[model samples]
Target: MTDKSKKVTENSDFIITLNSLTRFVLGAVGGYNMQTKLKGVREMNDGSIFNSSHTLEIEKDLLLFFNTWVDIQGDKFSNDRKGFQLVTTLIQALGLVFHHIWHCCSNMSKTERTHQIYIAAKKLAQINYSRDAEHWKNCSFLTLNEDDLNYKVNSGGSTTRKHFARYLCSKIGFNY
Candidate 1:
């Protein structure tokens, strides 16, 4: 085979190995419930559990995996930039999955919401390295700023909103 073909085969093998390792880790972590649900989806026509309430445990594990993967990818960047990008994209995809899960769980019980939020915060703490932390922090900062502004406007406090916006902009290094 050509050199390019060999590289492709090697990459595929690496991905398979990584996937096997992930499954093993998840299994060891007591992921039987998730595995069963996934198996149900594949084996039954109406077995999909798309709602968050029904898949809370699985979502929690997925969240944990995504956060851990991002940290690992950040470390890998020191050795390989392209590989880092691929892993980073995978992390982003996980975040998207979490967003969907959150939407599905929105109407769930308060206890469930609290549990998911706690999991999210814990996972976020793992993102302490530079690349991952920067992205996550910026997203959080923007979200907070938007929420603050909305709250101020809804509460009928233009002056306070302006002051808060100014403070946030300055803190974020925004000129003018």
Candidate 2:
């Protein structure tokens, strides 16, 4: 049987690359809607608190999508009601980041997607790490990369913004 005509036996074979799957999910015209949603997420007191159920739904979706790949054990913080709340809050923060990424390149052509992702990466880096424009522009995006969920959080389950930012960026294929 020819490679092109062979029937796939595994579900994993259906997805050749994460970017391709992401591209399919973020279809043409998805950017505008994502942008509007991002504005809403941003307006929700920086996604630390979710008031709308619609936003909550999207946040849940984001968590499912993300955790399906790399399980972010919120229990890493602690094991109790407070840990549960911590997990939910962390999911909300990451959902905002996912929305921001989709909003950046969802409507762009393949040729322009890298540039858009780069811009998004730079902006994210600025938000979480450095404010210097030239520094990020010249630095490697991989510099932001780290282990999936093992980050330095204080006793209260709080961490720097860069931790989540880098994980999402790395998983989303931000390499330079």
Candidate 3:
């Protein structure tokens, strides 16, 4: 594929995968959810019991994965946002998945722990993603009605999203 086409493809994968994983964290698999997007919580869906220890462990693991992925992805995807944004677009989507999962995307800081993830990411990547973070400084960064459910991202139809979903599954020790 041409360089431009390759970029588009890669970026598409990144977004689709990100959205799927975020929804999974929010307890959705069939499609994207906006109403209960971190606004609601239900029983654990990972087949594992929900306890303080498990939750803490998952948070730690997710944060580590986010940082490591960003550090390595910068080489593969592109400069800026640690290769999270493979192409130039209006959306600042690099750390968005993490925010979405943690429900800290709102402009108003959600909690000390969630806010620290952003700080920690900066410390680890040594890149200033403040602009993108500000852009997504809301409960939902994707509001065009396009980034969540449509575009064949979260419906179990693509390889990239599938891979991310599997990773999330593994994080919870869920056999998928």
Candidate 4:
């Protein structure tokens, strides 16, 4: 079968690449409604957060659809600006999606496995590790072998905002 026909497997590197591309794409559409909604989140003095769950659901759907569309197109647009833009949009959507997913995981009670996944996703987001670094720092952890959950917590913030995206896929079954 052609590579395009085969399913894309889940992996940290791919997700990170997608996230970076997404962030770049967001730059092109800075005033987008979704972007505005994400940036408009408000926290009140009484500790109540005012945000739209409807918007979050829209973001989630967009992310899923964009990623799936990319998979459907495969490498056909790989060598052009459209390809770059598409990838960027897909990645940026991924970062937003995961950002929200982490929040959802945080607010809900979960199974031990899911909770552990959430913790890793949190640390991964905190460290801002590149996918390679994320792989080095937490691949094993992601696989359930770590004794210390806070391992990536103390790392520098120079890491890219890609780990949560990766974690969403590898740990939480976010198929592209």
Candidate 5:
């Protein structure tokens, strides 16, 4: 294989390794229970403290994963294309995960989790818009269009501002 391809493969392997380690750590730290609670929120509108606890646990895991990845790859990348691609992929994964968490939280009965989700979403949107308004200028991934906005207003949770922020964070590599 070519040198660049080899490098990409190596980087990808490293990322996979890191992902596995993070999952392991999360599992050890009661991530499974958190995941179950998140699933429960999605399946049922039960707004319990379990949901809040799960959200907090997942959030902590996300922060740790990002910090660890950055620490390992920060100096090694140095503007390299492969490194940039890796970082971007990681960010996208993070945003997607956060969006899913938000969705789960939103599913809960109007309670603290729901409120937290709304607040988090708003924060994410603000951060994205502030960092680069242009990134969302022409994007239509999540009902950014006028029609979509009107539709969402009519149907709640169809498209959330928080999910949009998560997407922007993923795209722009915002260290949230």
Candidate 6:
């Protein structure tokens, strides 16, 4: 076979295997197939107990696998649109799934957190995200200027909203 045809076959096979694995993992955790999706405290069609701890552990393992796979194979798929999409979608979906699980398990949901940040942000005039989230998280910056304060990098996802809000506050000489 030509190199391109061989690569296409490999990519197709990988996609099929990944989809099957995702369905199996979801089913094992919730006792229902992915088609009939369910999350925390939601009723499964089969009425089986959803073992959340087990699910988290399994999901953690999958997360690690995906992280490592991306680290190793991300470049191989970069030039191939289908392969890149498959890899990225798998990683993004798994990240979102884990985030949802974390939100369900946490006392504070992302929305609540964002609201709290919004209230804090109201005190300051800054509305847009304009600082590195790590500054707020660490809360130990030797010196910060107005220009340095309101810059956003790597700011997306539920967890970062609060961080972004805090960053915004920091830009206006507010410590959050």
**Model 2 per-residue lDDT tens digits across residues 1-176:** 12342221233233123332332232211321322242233223233433445344344444344543233333332233222113322333344455566455557764465455444434442332222222333323223224533222332212322334344455456531
TM-score of each: 0.22, 0.28, 0.29, 0.24, 0.24, 0.26
Residue 156 alpha-carbon offset, candidate 5, angstroms:
16
Tens digits of per-residue lDDT for model 5, 13-76: 3433443333333332332333222222332234344324554645653554445444544444
Local accuracy of candidate 1 as per-residue lDDT tens digits, 1-176: 12222121223433223433332232322222332232333222245533435445455555554455445545542343323123322222233334343445569885786466445534443433333323434332222235332211122122322332233223333321
Candidate 5 residue 35 Cα shift, in angstroms, is: 17
lDDT of 4 at 20: 43
Q: RMSD in angstroms, candidate 1? A: 18.1
Candidate 3 lowest-lDDT run of ten: 27-36
Q: Best lDDT goes to which candidate?
A: 5
Please tell me which model should have the higher TM-score, number 3 or number 4.
3
lDDT at position 85, candidate 6: 27
Residue 106 displacement in candidate 3 (angstroms):
33
Error of 2 at 101 (Å): 2.1
Lowest lDDT sum, 10 consecutive residues, model 2, at 23-32
- Residue 127 C-alpha lDDT in model 1: 38
Number of colliding residue pairs in model 2: 0
